[model samples]
Target: MKKLVFVFAFFLCLAISAQDNYYTMYSFVVEPQNEATVYKLVEDYYSKNKPEGIYVRLFENHFKAEDMKATHSIVFLGTQEAVGNMYAGGGNVNFDLFITKLNQYIKDGAGSAMGKHIALNGDTSTRYPFQVYLLLDVADPDKYDAEHQKFHSKHNPPGMLVNMGNVIAGQGTGHYNRWAILGYKDMKSALGGPNQLLSGPALAARQKAWDAYRASNGGVEVVGSGMRVLLGAW
Candidate 1:
């Protein structure tokens, strides 16, 4: 009875921890005339006044999607509250100047989404130069998440960051339940190919795991996957 209670408590703690780690992303296309100005302003602002507990990364979309266009910029926020505060004209240092420049230089419209981290692997501190965004339609979120976590644990690659998040609110396709961010060191590394983390026997093992996961769940469908180049980060 005591052992079972301890195991339950351990898993409960993990669930709470996961909930505490939140991410918010805003995607928008830069106006043709203001592209240079927008980039300079963002770089200058973040360099001077870095936000507390927030790791900011700016990405430019590399691949074209049916719904999304190239040159789209994605701002990744480390905290959920940061999203609300950022748009509410509060919290961020130099908010007035930042908002003013952003409004002046960028498009008026943007897409936003908030999600909590389910699983993560590799170095989270160092900023990578490129990222692969995987938008998925999950049939069984819980089971799919478990398999994803297991896969990363077994075949995690060095210098590669893999993180999965469950979308709770905001824009993009309503069918996408979860998204995964795969960070790579450089453009060359990113373009090298898929399943870079798994090799030899590990690759086989991962395939088997995926097969089992698919069999159990109705089957996972990938809505869209795109690569993005890092523009600037702080």
Candidate 2:
């Protein structure tokens, strides 16, 4: 009886500790009219107070879906304590401070950052319903620029890449710990849409591509992970 009770207590403790890693996602819709100004602000923020959560990623668009200039910018924050400390520290402490510092540092930069907090929505009761992917591709420098430019011409996202080069792009927000492999079906659903444009047989083909992608050293893959969607129509 004591052993069973001890095991239960241990699991309960783990569950509680796990909650500490909760991440808050902030998404923005940048105005194209202020694209230049917004881009400047992004660079300024990245320079002054380097926050690891800020990730610039590419989300390809498919038929029936809208594509724009920039894909999306993501910020991966650690546990609540990580965020709390950021705000509590004051100067250069929180995001607001980062903005203020940027504004002042710039010679004649007039632009502001706007964002909305995304809370946990949908069925939380289900264990890991959504799939999270953290992909890192080799810095082809040239290819990166081309693909990003193509992604831009195709999709008009609200964010911009103030500075681009041979660098590491970190992309993941919310529920960082979970799945490590991208399920081929889900990727197709997101990219191709439910109609299965890849074709019935192509479904297996996509998995093959994913497997090949994983095998290649060009990209790092994290699958089965779950995250709360902050923006877009879901």
Candidate 3:
């Protein structure tokens, strides 16, 4: 079985940010033999602290870029206000303790990105626990965004949620400025099955549009692409 190749997905920029959801992701290296311990600590922390309208997920990175310097990523999502104030004026003893404990299992921190939710298609739920993320360097933001919406609305699967965003504040962004996240029911679905994958005219049209997009704006580069398993969400 082969996963659907995450190619030519037009992950647009600020002009497409109509959704209020914002997200931040921390890329970190895990201490050897402490993966479970790290996850448990985070799970315990979120389970107790209990913030409103905030979502958190731990992702085990697979086939990630060599330069990433991380085996896992912690992603936090919420309304702009909630996310911006997630750690604001923190004075809680428990929260401070949680951080202290968490740091022990983390070997090193690589980078992080804060972005706005640009567009969303299909369903949004935990049912789709697997994801594919393509970090892209977008040139013509509006053009790609328009084409992306039109293409996915007609060709995407039932539960396939496609989320795109522009990176507002990012550490180690390198050359990429946007991200396209695709969700699936499970690893098998994410990796694909016996049936033919994305074939036929739909794929062709998308490729053609992508080629044109590249021609006009120097070129669009996929900075990196990889799969992630969702470990926890809250």
Candidate 4:
């Protein structure tokens, strides 16, 4: 059977320039049994010490009823340099030195321990199971926009492309090693098929559309790689 070509869809900012903005998304997979404890700890951290480099947006995607524990928590960033700072304990702030910072936040009555929570960090090159996409260009951001509008547009997932002046970000690596988390709002949904397998003339059209969009816009540039944190809503 011929496979469908499904283009992954998401949006991001420009490269790692002094003025460049980067968005980071984080997925923390916590132990299911420690749901309340985990949420409390995470909430406490955000309240006292706001994450630097990127703005934090948190959510727990529950598939079955709300009874299920949070699968992961997500955060977005506005700059790559800012993120580097956060990972390194920005300013004189030293996360490594204050190892108990995270521990102290968790509600004490909760029996669960903080160490159980899974984290992907600088020392740990291991990446959490996630999908990533680089924002390229938009052909006609004004065109067919209303057709794509939805309820709760604020949380509306990132659009295919927007105005030319808008920024564009992509992974630094040539190969897309990140697993793509397909969603209802993605290009795969719009095209009504898989875009990954597209080839020959079809691929050419895809490239052309992106080129035209970039040209019409202010052109595209790098932001960050797939390994960096990135966030998207659907």
Best by TM-score: 3
lDDT of each: 0.67, 0.32, 0.70, 0.35
- TM-score, candidate 3, is 0.79
Mind giving the per-residue lDDT tens digits that candidate 1 earns over 111-131? 666567778888878777788
Q: Write the per-residue lDDT of candidate 2 for residues 126-208, one digit (tens) a residue.
A: 33222333323433434443443343233211111111121111233322221121222234343433225344554565555
What is the model-wide C-alpha lDDT for candidate 1?
0.67
Better of 1 and 2 by TM-score: 1
lDDT of 4 at 119: 12
Best-fitting candidate, measured by lDDT?
3
Clashing pairs in 1: none
RMSDs, each prediction? 10.1, 18.4, 8.0, 15.9
Better of 2 and 4 by lDDT: 4
Model 3 over residues 1-234: C-alpha lDDT tens digits? 121111111222434333489877777788669899999998998887766768888888876777766788888788766765664635478876777788777887766677788778876654667888888887777776766666566556565678888887664746776678888877777777212235567557656655554555444678788888888876
Give me the displacement of residue 23 in model 2, in angstroms. 2.5
